[model samples]
Target: MEKKRILITGAAGFLGSHLCDRFLAEGMYVIGMDNLITGDLKNIEHLRSSEYFEFIHHDITKYVDISGTLDFILHFASPASPIDYLKIPIQTLKVGALGTHNLLGLAKDKEARILVASTSEVYGDPLVHPQTEEYYGNVSPVGPRGVYDEAKRFMESITMAYHRFHGVDTRIARIFNTYGPRMRLNDGRVIPAFIGQALRGEDLTVFGDGSQTRSFCFVNDQIEGIYKLLMSTYHEPVNIGNPTEISIKDFAEEIIKLTGTDQKIVYKPLPTDDPLQRRPDITKAREVLEWEPKTSRTEGMKITYDYFKNLPEAELYKKEHRDFRSHTKG
Candidate 1:
């Protein structure tokens, strides 16, 4: 019997690298694609020796060409961190819009199931609490973060259009905040930022009085939910995340405790359009995909801390800036 084949974009990034591992573990041939714009090759370096894995150094916003039977395509490309998208907003927009279009077209030609990685940001300082699939988001298209929010919103719109019009098999995973190993220590998300600061013996910076809340899902559980959604027969979007919510202030305290650091919490003004609350209502996922996150924050954070703590001393103090000039296009 021939093994299944999968193409995962952003394959060198945190979640994409993990997805590659998961698919290969299922005995599938995997093609990992990335442009190294925001993705680090180090994340996928360990898989280089596996015959089942192959890495492509290409950006997905341009055309995508894959050989032979492509059974599945998980579109995980794009700069997910706020620090990244804020710097390369245009590139972020292109990957979510043009990149998604190209992949959907490829899926159409190859007759493969495609799962596009959407995000909880689509909720956009959501008016609805515990965001449900039915709530139309309160996004500001012209805001600073709108580059990412609108891009994903457009990605979802076009994905559904393809599904309804061209009969392409599609799955949209509206992923919430997820963290674990291989996460860049300076991605500007709360979890890694707090952990990184704790590791560096610096004060944990809490924005907006540290009152805004975010629920985090462990990477393993996030990957499981995504895998289940891709295999299921459902066509619409599904919320995949842990509903365990925490405030920034409290979460900062937890991080300090986890790292055994005596760092104090410092407050700063929150960024514009930052969501005051975020929690996914996974009723659809539970009912349809039979999925719910199993890892507790305590368990997941310890594993993540261990991973980061073991990194080279230089990584702990690394800045968040990157040069996107080589990858950016006009």
Candidate 2:
């Protein structure tokens, strides 16, 4: 029997690297792609020697060229963190818009199933809590974070256009906040930020009175939902995340307990356009893909904390700002 061939963009990033592991476990020939912009090579370096794994060190937004047939394409490439997207705003927009288009084109040529990784940010300080797929969203097209949000919005739009007009098979996963091992300590998301602070004996910084809420999914749970979505026939977007939401202040407290640190929680003004609340309504996911998150926060956090704790001392203090002067067109 022939093994399925799969191409995963952003294959060196946190979630992307995990997806590569999942697919390879299923006996697929995996091709990993990344520009090393926000992704660290160490994430996928262990897979380099695998006979079934191949890597392409190229940016998807420029032009994508693969020689053989691909059974599936997972478009997970983008500067996913606020710290990253903010530093490379234009590149973030390009990857979501142009990078998605390029992958969609490749999927069409190969007649392959393609899934583009969408985000909860499309809800945009959502007027509707526990967001569902039917919501048209309340995103600001010109906000400071608009580059990433709008670009993903455009990604979903063009993807559907290809499906509807060009007869291409497409899937969209509207992912919520997810964290686990391999996450950069300086990614600036709440989990890593809080964990990093607790580890360094610094105060956990909470923005906007520490009242803003977010729901987090452990990486394994999230990847399971995504894998099920790829195998299912449902074509519309589906939400994949844990429904148990937590406030920034409370979450910081949990981190302090988990890390055994006496760090205090400190408040700061929230960044502009930061969502006041985020939670996903996974009714469609449950009914269609029959999926829900399985990892408990206590269980997941311990695993994630241990991964970061064992890292080199230098990584804990590293900052992730990218220099765009050397940025490629992708």
Candidate 3:
């Protein structure tokens, strides 16, 4: 059988790179596109010499020209981290809205199946305990974090519109907190923040008295969930994340144990719109795709720590730690 031809946006990112590796391992010919806005080439550099893998340096929001029938299109672009999107708010909104629309058009033209990497942030500060796909989010459009939140919500809307209007096969994976190797240490997310600080012997800053809760799925399980979703018949958005929730304070303690560092855990002022708690109801995912995260936090943290431990001494300790946490509490 001919290998499937897959194109992944944000292919150099943490999730995207891992997805590329997964697809390539499955004997698929993969085309990776990125403008390197938030992604580093080093992430995908290992595949530079692979005959089945091609990396394109371009923005997905811009026009994309390619040949061959595209078997799959995974749109994972956009600035995900608070530090990244906040620095380029306009780009974040544009990629989610315009970039996703463009890729949906590509899927229609090629009759390819496509998946958009949506985020738990779309649920805003959750009013429900564990947010299911049916819950419409409580978003603050005018807030500082609105750029990413509202943008992702718009991405999902456009994706569904394509599925409805153009008869395109689309899947939206509302990804939750995914952590593992290749996570940019300066992304301002809590996991990397705590790890980076502890590795460097700095304090672990916990925002808002450390009461906010989140579920972190290992990258391997997340990539598996996304791949299953892309290949399955299910078309609606599905929540892809671990259901086990942990408070920020407890998460810090876990990091302390994993790294075995005596870093001080400090309380800090919370940012606006941070969610009190967020976990995925993956019942739909399990029933439909038979997918559930297998890597527990303890094991995933060890893998991530091992990866970061190998980082160069300079990159390992030179990040300018910021004071504010992301408002998208999920």
Candidate 4:
């Protein structure tokens, strides 16, 4: 079979880089595009040697130029974190709306199947315990986190619009808390934040009594589910995440144990609009795509720690990230 040509936007971020690696390993030609706003070249620098991997510095909100018939499109580009999106709210909005629209246009031109990376966040501090794709989210459009939440919601609407109106092949994966290698040390996501702090022997911070729950799926499992969904027949938003629910506090303590850090726990004020609870109902995923998360949080953290631990001494971003964790062990 002839190899497929796939274009991935936000191809430099944690998940994007991993997707590129997966595709290239399968002998596919991969084109990676990123603006480097929240992504770093170091994450994907190793892939430069692959003859099938190509990287371009371009913003998705701006016009994207490409040639040849693309077989797949993964629009993973967006400011995903609260801190990052809060810092650059407009960019997040533009990427979700304008950026996604442009890519749908490209998909039309190339006659390619496209997957827009949606999130559990679209469910907002969900009223439903284990969020399913059919559950309409309880989100606040005027909340502090509105920029990202609303942007993602808009992306879903437009993606469906393209699918229904233009007959564009589309897939939407409502991704949950995914953590593993290549995650930015200071991206402010919980897993990396805890690991960085524990590694540096600093206090770990848990917000709002540390009772907020989340389900974590390792990066490899996430990539696998994503690849399968793209090739499968499921089209509506599918929840892709582990079903094991752990509170933020318990998760922090586990990281401390894994890292062998005797760091104390510190109580920090929770961020505005922080989701009270989040877990994915992967029942549909298992039934339709025959997909279930294979990596445990403990095993995933160990692997992730090994990668960050291998970083050079001069990589002080990890060092500075220690400041975020408090000493409270709870």
TM-score for candidate 2: 0.98
Q: List the candidate 4 regions with Cα displacement exceeding 4 Å.
A: 316-330
Residue 308 deviation, candidate 3, in Å?
A: 0.9
Per-model clash counts, in order, read 0, 0, 1, 12
Model 2 stretches with alpha carbons more than 4 Å out: 328-330
Question: Ten residues in a row with the worst lDDT in model 3?
Answer: 321-330
Better of 3 and 4 by TM-score: 3
TM-score of each: 0.99, 0.98, 0.96, 0.95
| Rank ordering of all candidates by TM-score, starting from the highest | 1, 2, 3, 4
Candidates sorted by lDDT, descending order?
1, 2, 3, 4
Per-residue CA lDDT of candidate 3, range 29-142, in tens?
Answer: 999999887888999999999999999998777788779879999999988888788877777888888788889989999999999999999999989879999999889999
Q: Identify the runs in model 1 with alpha carbons over 4 angstroms from their true place.
A: none
Q: After superposition, how far is residue 241 of candidate 4 from its true place, in Å?
A: 0.8
| Model 1 clashing residue pairs (backbone) | none
Candidate 2, residue 306: Cα displacement in angstroms equals: 0.8
Model 2 vs truth, CA RMSD = 1.1
Residue 198 displacement in candidate 3 (angstroms) = 0.4
lDDT of 2 by residue, 1-330 (tens): 999999999999999999999999999999999999988899998899999999999989888999988999999999888888877888888898889999999999999999999999999999998899999888888988999999999999999999999899999999999999999899888899998998899999999998889999999999999999999999999999999999988999999999998988888999999999899999999999999999999999999999999999898988765677566343
Alpha carbon lDDT of residue 162, candidate 1? 96
